[model samples]
Target: MTSATLGPLLAEARADGRALGAFNVITLEHAQAVAAGAARAGVPAVLQLSQNAVAHHGGELAPLAAALTALAHAAPVPLALHLDHLDDGPLGRRLLREAPEAGFGSVMFDGSALPAEENVAATAAAVAFGREHGLAVEAELGRIGGKPGDAHTPGVRTDPGEAAEFVAATGVAALAVAVGSSHAMTVREAALDQPLIAELRAAVGVPLVLHGSSGVPDEELRAAVRSGMTKINVGTALNVALTGAVRQRLVDEPGLVDPRRYLADGRTAMTETVARLLAVLHGAAPAVPSARALPADGISPRPR
Candidate 1:
């Protein structure tokens, strides 16, 4: 199936009263794995590339964009390519300008680390940029600590009143509110404030987004969706799966110099992780059909 725009995907998820899984893609392999997982689960998914990831790959988003767009078209389920966590003002503006042309469904302009007024101002700018490009915009309201190469600082939970004002000021398509979830957490121990989420939902008209969701337990994740979160971003869990798989592969085969072999293992592990997350987002059992169940032509079988 061809990829759909982010607006429609999030709108549909909201209409259906379910949260859409937005997985972070750090490499070409990660993009493929996320697509394959969505195909296997027969659910729509978003493949996102963080600004940090783009920087890590030498500040070129074109290669990863091309790969994700191709996978989006090839997948059995609807997919969306998103530019995630853009912090640098100039680079963020450039990506916001180039993303729609490059086939991205959405762009998340993160200015959470900035002062409240600056964050609101910058996010409003990004929202305006997104409007000109006819692309969806996601802006962060509260600080979710744990950026790459940083010490883990607990997130300062978002104030419902502030969140409402921020969304109104920015005209963002989605609002990512911090409800006690932190980035890069390997353990599922983040305590979510459902009451805050509910309050924010009441205050903010747009869909609520939860970042650093990998640390949120399954129960909390489900509760978040029930409470009003429309988009949940997962990163650390996928990174854990990918790295662990690669490490195990190398340990099992000590002299393996081929990048493809280890990367393939990592991809497989990431795919499985995505499948489980999709199942949870869909509120379905995790035993979904595998990718192999898709027809040779790459179309998934209709549900019985």
Candidate 2:
């Protein structure tokens, strides 16, 4: 399948009353498993590279960007590379200018930490750069409430009127609005404010994004899509899967010497995670895979 751009993928998913799933890639296994999972689900997905991911690989993105793009190109289903949650620092601005060439079809410029006016101006400049570069620019204003030693304010939420105003001022391709979900939640019980989501969707002209969505339950996710959310971002959930699988493999097979053995299981877990989430986004109940052997190629394998 060909690497795709956000415009067509968004249009296609919107037409089907489904939201696009964007999963973060922190490691090469994440990229490979996400691609294989999307292929198994037979849906397009965005393989996201976030600022934290850049730091994870080294303090630069070039090494990982090219490899992720190569994975997207080799994905069995249409996939796109996205730069997620990049700040407005020197490196951020430089990346904004170079992302298109780095094989990213979309980039999220996060000016959310800045004061209100500064956030607007920074986002507007990013929008301008994206406009000239033919890239889709995603913007986040304020914070989607969450906690991990209080990294983001736990109760702050996005106001619909403010969101509409920000959209008009910034010309962002999509907007991530804070409803009620918290980030990095291991439990699937975040109560989303459907009314607020509907209100924001009505006020904002662009597609609405639901970030920190791994904490959202299946029924809540379907309701969010029904209420007008168009893009769903999930991260910690996949990490949970990968880490758990790798840990279990090591425990169950103590003599396993090859790192590939545990890594393969981790990749398999993430592949299954991606496929299941795609099904949820498609408004279908997740199904258990039939008992069948998966191929052991470096690329994750799923029953076709």
Off by over 4 Å in 1: 148-155, 287-304
Query: Model 2, range 140-259, lDDT digits (tens) per residue?
Result: 988776733333665567899999999999999899988878777656767789988889888988888999897787788889999989999999778877777777776777899998
lDDT of 1 by residue, 130-201 (tens): 888788999887667667643335656778888788888999999888788878777677789998888888
Instruction: List ranges where model 2 is wrong by over 4 Å.
Output: 147-155, 287-304
Please name the candidate that would achieve the greatest TM-score relative to the true structure: 2
lDDT of 2: 0.83
**TM of each candidate vs. truth:** 0.90, 0.90
The pairs that clash in candidate 1 are none
lDDT, residue 14, model 2: 67
Candidate 1 residue 286 C-alpha distance from true site, Å: 4.0
